[model samples]
Target: MNATGRQTDLIEDYVAALTAALHGPARVKARMIEEIRDGLADTAAAHTGEGMPYHRAAHQAVQEFGTVEELVPSCQQELTIAQARHTARAVALTAPFLIACWYLAQAADHGHAWLLPRTAQLLAVHLTGVATVAALLAAATLAATGALARRMPTPHRLPLVVAWAGTTASAAMAVTTLAFATVSALTTNWPLLAFAGTLAAASHAAVAASARACRRCSRLPTT
Candidate 1:
């Protein structure tokens, strides 16, 4: 049964204290609280079925749930890895955009006019292959890091840092390449070049935001 009567107050107080001791995303915190309440309520229901009164069942349930102190460390660690996994997934999704944007910028600048008929087709093909490799490496790195975050008992600290570093580096490369394209466009008055640069700028912005989130997750204690 759901929390009812005195059980509600007791569960609320316990969850509040548990939340105060834990640090993570709000969603995870709320989920943990919900799960605890559900378990406690079930326990209380079982006690009441044994002929215990409502108030006594609630207290008994709380007692049986054990001390929150011992649960806090594990909860915090779980939240940390989950957060890292989230960032890794984000990196996987966006890193390809960084690759594509950088490739586009380079091709447009090298070939002129944002890959028009007059653009150098041979050079464009070569840049495409290079960008594909970078994108693949980035994807693999993030995927591995994401898996590590999900299951490893300890933080894959070095690998996680490397993955994020690679992500940021890829974005930085895109920005630098796009800057050149932007300059080339301004000099030649190529409107499509500006669009390529704009996309690269957007990818760079996303990487910057992800970097901040990564830094926060890195601070979590994994031991």
Candidate 2:
């Protein structure tokens, strides 16, 4: 085969091997592939300029990138962290919906009259309002966190940490409110309490799972 054909075959072989080894998010795989492709191309050109055949330069480039067997473990670890971060973000996004579910359960039990008591209704109203504000602020911060997947896992800082805190606090408060309401309704509206309690439990469970995942993701080097 010609020099150009040989070089193309080498590049294709290298890329195919790398791709087979990468079991990460599609975006990560694509990004890494592009980077490696350009890097190999550059390295090969440099070797060719130094009196090497194109195919020989390409061979050198492939060897330089390490074998697929060598790359898989490291790539898998990196992508696991990325997957964790992605999961945490998805959980956070569900917070508002979960919070709403809690309210709907309560409304179903008490009709509109359940919230008629000034103290009880006002308290839930205020807490939910706080949760809303916190959730909104947290969203802005959390959006930037996905960027971390491109780099390495580091201890979460700045907006991500703060955003997570806000979300955690909101979920806790919502659950607390649900608990109190459930307890008050235990005697007269036990059936309603059952319904409301179920939804609250679901919310709490989701929050717990999300928090745990985020904590794991936040710790630097989760490998």
Candidate 3:
């Protein structure tokens, strides 16, 4: 194939790969690809010094633009936000199941004692409330991630710092939760409480990190 044909093929492949990697809304993928293509075209124009044929210029431009692997990290800052959204969806889906488990554990512990029925009921109600909150949080995180993905064009250092801080917080929360869960499981203490707390903390941290990463990505200049 000629240089133009080769460049076209490269662009086509790049778009397809981006679509698969992003796995979010079609509009997002389309917009991202369009930006990348424009960037490549501009870079080629600069490289050629004169306006060469589209194919040759484009091919040279793309070749200079580097491979997909190099580009993905820059793109992945936005993708992190998309991942956060997916994570939120997972959290929402898991909420009811977690509540059900909480109830079942309560029942098993209580046996048929018929005592503390009110307490059991209250616990179940509380679990439901927690689940509802989790669902809401998940939805909010997803929406925020989507919005961040749209607005930020390049990676910024400040956002990355914030994201790292969030990740550290999340790691700390996870460790604490794991410790609590271990204690609760071994001693039959507050397993449900520990588990719920851990999950919520971790989810929040993940969302924060994702958002920060997206913001940082927006600051990076495209080639």
Highest TM-score model number:
1
Candidate 3 residue-wise lDDT, 76-97, digit = tens: 6555454445445555555555
TM-score of each: 0.65, 0.52, 0.42
- Model 2 per-residue lDDT tens digits across residues 1-223: 8769878889988888877756544686688778878999999999999999888899998888777676656665565445444444544565565457447546655544654456556655765665565565456444544664457544435324543654565465556547656555645655655655565556556555545544544442323
Q: Model 3 Cα displacement at 213 (Å)?
A: 18
Model 1 RMSD, rounded to 1 decimal: 6.2
- Please list the residue runs of candidate 3 whose C-alpha ends up more than 4 Å from where it truly belongs after superposition: 1-3, 45-49, 86-127, 139-223
What local lDDT does model 1 show for residue 110?
Answer: 67
Give the C-alpha lDDT of model 1.
0.60
Instruction: Summing lDDT over every window of 10 consecutive residues in candidate 2, give the lowest-scoring window.
Output: 214-223
Candidate 1 per-residue lDDT, tens place, 1-223, comes to 5546556788768878887777555687689878988898899889899999877898888888877776676676666655555555555565565556545556545644543433434434543454455456556555655565467534357435633664554455464555546465555645655666566566556555555655665565544
